[model samples]
Structures are given as C-alpha cells and as structure tokens.
Target: MRLKNCHNFKDFRKLAESRLPGPIFNYIDGGADDEVTYRNNTSCFDKCDLIPNVLRGVESVDMSVTVMGQKLDLPVYCSPTALQRLFHHKGERAVAAASEKYGTMFGVSSLGTVAMEEIREKHKNPQVFQFYFHKDRGLNRAMLERAKAAGVEVLMLTVDSITGGNRERDLRTGFSIPMQLTLGGMMQFAMKPMWGINYVTHEKFRLPQLESHVDMSGGATSIGRYFTEMLDPTMNWDDVAELAEFWDGEFCLKGIMSGADAKLAADAGCTGVILSNHGGRQLDGSSTAFNQLTEVVEAAGDRLDVMMDGGVQRGTQVLKALSLGAKAVGLGRYYLFPLAAAGQAGVERALGQMRAEIERDMKLMGVTSLDQLTRSNLRFR
Candidate 1:
C-alpha cells in the first residue's frame, strides 16, 4: 500500500514494511524476546470497553492537555526513539516539523540523528530530551547542560533500560550500528534499492547526540555495547534525584511501571512519570503501560503528571488512558511507521488522522473536553 491509502496504524505499518529494509523495519517493529509484553500493550485495551453517552450536544472537542509543564494541543505526544535517519532520510527533522504542525511535544532521543540544538533552533514547539544515566557522571552532567542550553522543555530519564533487552530479531538480522548484516540481511537491503539509494544519497548517518563523547565510528561501538558498558546499571533514586535537581525544570522519569516507583519519582522532584516499558523493547513479559496506568496515577497523579506510552494506536486508546487518569499519552512506532513510509508528509498524515480520530471519538463519547472523561466511563470485561 502507499501513504495515501494508509488510514490506520496497521496500514502505515504495512506501507513502512514495504518501503523500508528488513533490518530497519524490524528495528522499529520488533520488541524484546518473545514480545509478549509488546503484543499485550495494545491487547490489554480490549479488556476494557468504553461506555459512550448519547444525546449530548457535542459540537466541538478540545483535546488539549498539559503534561510535565508544556501544553499540548493533543493528548498524545511523540516519544523519542533511536536512529530515525535510518528509517527515513528526513529523520528527526521530519518528526519535529510534524509535531510542531500538530502542536504537540516531540522527544529527541539520546541516540537521535539530529542535534538537539538544531531541532530547538528550527522548531518552536515544546521539545523533550530523552537520555539515560551514564556510568560517567561528568558526561551525564554535560549532556544535561547541553539540553538546558538548547532550551529543551522536558528532561526524560529512561530508567528501565539499565541494559539492553534480548532483541532476537536484531540477532537474526545481524543488525548493529555500523550494520554488520548477514548475507540474508544484505539481500533484504538489496531488495529495497530505493531505501538504499535514499540512505546513501543523504548525509552520512551519525548520532549527533553522542558523537561528541562516544566513538561510534567504524563499528568501534554498538548500541548494545553502549547500554551494557556505558549506562550505569547502579542508577538509583539518588542518581535520579541529583539529575532532577540539576535539570531543575520539567523533569520526568520514563519507563516507570510501578506505583511505588512512581511515588519515588514524585518525591524526588519529578514533574511527571511516564508509565512505559520502553515500548516493550525492554523486559519481555513485563506489564504493559496501559495495565499499570491506574496504579501509577493513584500513587502520584496528585503530586505530578502520570503519563503512559506503548500500544497507543487508536484515538479511543488515548481516551481510555485519559479516562483512567493519564494526563497524556505518548506515541512511538505509531508515527515512526508513517515516517518510514513517506517521510515528513507521512508523519503529518498520521498525526492528522490521530487528531481527527480523537476529536470524533470524543464527540461520540459525549465529551467535549478531556476533563469530562472519568473512570466511570469504562466497564472492564
């Protein structure tokens, strides 16, 4: 299928699969070993049914939400993922522009292809810098300073990825930073010549965020190695507290899945805590964010914003999370697939569709504003 024919997440995913190379597409599609949690993230939504109210005059809808400290036109924002340029030549630039047009927050990954400074200079919308705590404290502090200098509105520390997950797809495809693809993988890339052409014709791929400190050249460092060797496995509440103090702004902890941990984040001065499992990219069989939303929200919702990511494909899913008490939701592969399919335009199309879905679903549910949604609107099956 083509971008024009894509109307939903699955359609965009199909187009992306057809256009992108196997390794690249799988990078965005695949989760941890077995992918049980990855599949369950969306499946859990099926357990609960929305009880819509009729005969209400719903002429207009307001989907705006303020999470962390930024006001978002939509309840959903783009969560940061690594190596966007590999998925599409436009990379973070495409995602950033689309988020700006949609008036939502866009996260810049520590492994993002575009520089935070450049994106900050280009986009006027709220931006978040998603990074990890490194073994080198000095490096972590410096990166925080850099983000502060760039005027990033949020600092999201990904606490779950102390180490990389067992992504068997990458192992099978032999996918790495420098790309030591197996013979079969090489054939897959060769099959998609258009992707290769665009990849080669564009500027050389580089992780601008880590290029200054990490030597990623000539396969000297792989992402797996970076996580295993560089990231601090000993990161604790103390470390997070220190970082939050240094950030001293809209700070949040991504990858938080437990109520107690969410409370700790609130006590540590976090402005928000994202109920995420790294999009099921880490820890197979872990609880989906949707499944853990209520616990996290109850524990810290009054203290700080409780947001969630993973398995958010439909607008109804966004509403369900909001009704359950999530201040906002995050999109990962939802927009990435569209980006891979048609670059910037594809992303905008996906965002526009999502906006429409939320608006229409809101009116149908007899709610004009997000505040009207409550736990009473849901019935668990």
Candidate 2:
C-alpha cells in the first residue's frame, strides 16, 4: 500500500483510504444523494469503445493539447477540489508543484486551503483559479480582481454550485468544516492518530482564498454556512457574461452539461466549457459530462474549447473523450486519492502513470498526435 506500489487509480484510492480517517476518505469518495452520478461519471466511458488502426507510424506520440488557451503537455489537467489541506498537509502547494513538473494546468478552488497568490508565485506552469459567484456583487468583483492580479492563466467559474448538494455522507459522519464530526466520526478520527498528528504538525488550515472577505477566524464560520449564506443561488447567464468580460482572458464555465448551456457559454464569450457534474458531488441524477460531450461539442465547439471530466479513470477513456471532440479532460479523485496517499510524490506518480498510459494508448491506437483522434476512431455501443 506504499507509494511505490501505487500504480493506478484503485491502488492510490486504497492507499489513501488506509492512510486517511474514514470521514476524510468519504469526503473525497462520496457523492450527493444516492451516489449514482458519482459512479456514472466513470461508467459513462464504457458506453463507447475505441477503434484502433494498425500499420500507422506511432513510435513517437505527442499528447500535447491546447484547451482554454493553455498548452498542456498531457490532455488532462488537475480539476479543482476543495480542502486539499484537509486531505494532505501540503495542500494545493503539492498539487501545483506536481502538475508543474508535468507541464499541465492545475486548478485552485475558492475553498482551497492555500492562497492562489502563493501557488502563482511558486509554479511556472499554467494555473486556473476556480471560484463561485457570491451573493454580493462586490465580493465577486474582488475575487475576480484578486485572481487577475495573481496572473492566473484561466478563470473557471463553477456555475453549478449555487447551493451545496445533499451530501448524506457528511451528515452521517458529521464531516463539516471546523470539525463538526458526530460521536462515531470522532471515534474514526481517533482511530487514525497519524492523520491527526500530521494535521496538527502542518501549518494551520484556513481558506486562504476567502479569509479576507469571509470571517473564518476564531471558528466564527463554516464551509456549510459559507455555501448557504454567501453563494448566489440565482446566478444566471448575465452575471457570467459580465464576469467573462471582466476576466477578459481565457475564461471557462465548469459544470456545463447540456448543449444549450454550452451554447450560452460561447455566447457569453467564454474561451472554454468544461463538461462536469462536479464529480457527481452535486445533482445526484444529473447526466454525466461524458454523456453530454458530443452534443455540447456540436453546439459550441466551433466557438470555444469543449472539455470534459468525470469517470476518467483510464488513459483509454481519455482517448475516447478526445476522439469524440473533447479538447482536454479534467481529473478529480484520480489525483486527489494519490495526493492523500503520499503527498507530492503520490501526485507525481499518478500524473506520470496517466501520461504513460496516454502515450502507450496513443501508439496502440496508431496515432502520433492528439489531432489524429476523431469520431471515425470510435464506435458507440
């Protein structure tokens, strides 16, 4: 179960489960309601199959792709997830560094434990700042200005999470921000003393992205309250359009699933549209981003980059998405579990494995570059 033994997604997940407490592991593993969408995120890839060609020169494979105006050496980038510090003491710092080593983009969430400025200063690779729309206009503007000042390469506004999803696992385990675990949950943490020791030994956990605007000092506020009270649930296309114009750069809309929404993202002047269902963390029965990819690409691909993330566990799955016209793919738990397993080294290993898988799969498919992948290379079941 050590880092060296971790070669794929399942191995990293098992190692992380063994290393982390039950509640913390579930926080990364659980989904909203019945957890159907979460499971479907990966299962949707099975509905389509890849068709390989033989006798095509493919000794050298180039997996590079340009999505959201960012050139990624691998077609997959690390999607943003909250509370990285909670999972690993190194937090966003580790993810940013590992992704930088691979020459790809890494997203920093508004709920990220580390500040975007710190990540921006430390990493030379392309960075994305993923934030939510706040109820207050001034707060939203301030967040945008802060990210812009930090010189973030991409602005990914998560459009789906106006209100938090009904995460039953959190309720059962009492895993809320500021450590509101139930009695059983408390016992689980006690079972994993190593995690507690690591948590206490590291730097204090604070949502650096929102520390100034939101008063989280002295246990005054919690993440649940922040989502319920701070986020603007009524956010519409107009607000997003203004934010896109304000960012005025490589702006993208994450959590996009439908063709209509993708078209709206293009009309709003977004540079890319990421087809995600928040890793099935929100809207339990919502369609998997992969299921909606072709429609969205047809609707808006001509105008903007169409990317997808969810259930992308294998390199062959990444190829399937690309063959269907995804500019790039995003990885959530695929990297998070590795981060939890062994910090920076674990993340680097996961990224390296993915790159190797993509390279091998590309050669097997008789393609030397990503552009060689097309709908013709795929067969839907």
In order of appearance, the predictions have TM-scores of 0.98, 0.98
Candidate 1: tens digits of C-alpha lDDT, residues 1-381: 777899999999999999988988888999999999999999999999999999899999889998887999999999998889989999999999999999999999999999999999999999999998999999999999999999999999998988788998988897865467999799999999999899889999888898887877644356557766788999999998899998899999999999999889988989999999888889999999988888888898589899999999999999999999999999999999999999999999999999999999999999999999999999988
Show where candidate 2 strays beyond 4 Å.
218-222
**Highest lDDT scorer:** 1
Q: TM-score of the candidate numbered 1?
A: 0.98
- The weakest ten consecutive residues by lDDT in model 2 span 215-224
RMSD of each: 1.1, 1.1
Record all residue pairs in model 2 with backbone atoms less than 3 Å apart, i.e. clashing.
Answer: 41-311, 42-311
Separately for all candidates shown, the number of backbone clashes (residues 3 or more apart, or on different chains) is 0, 2
- Please give the distance, in angstroms, between residue 225's alpha carbon in candidate 2 and its true position after superposition: 2.9
lDDT of 2 by residue, 183-298 (tens): 99999999999999999998887898988887775562565577778888899999989998888899999989899988898898898999989888889999998889889999
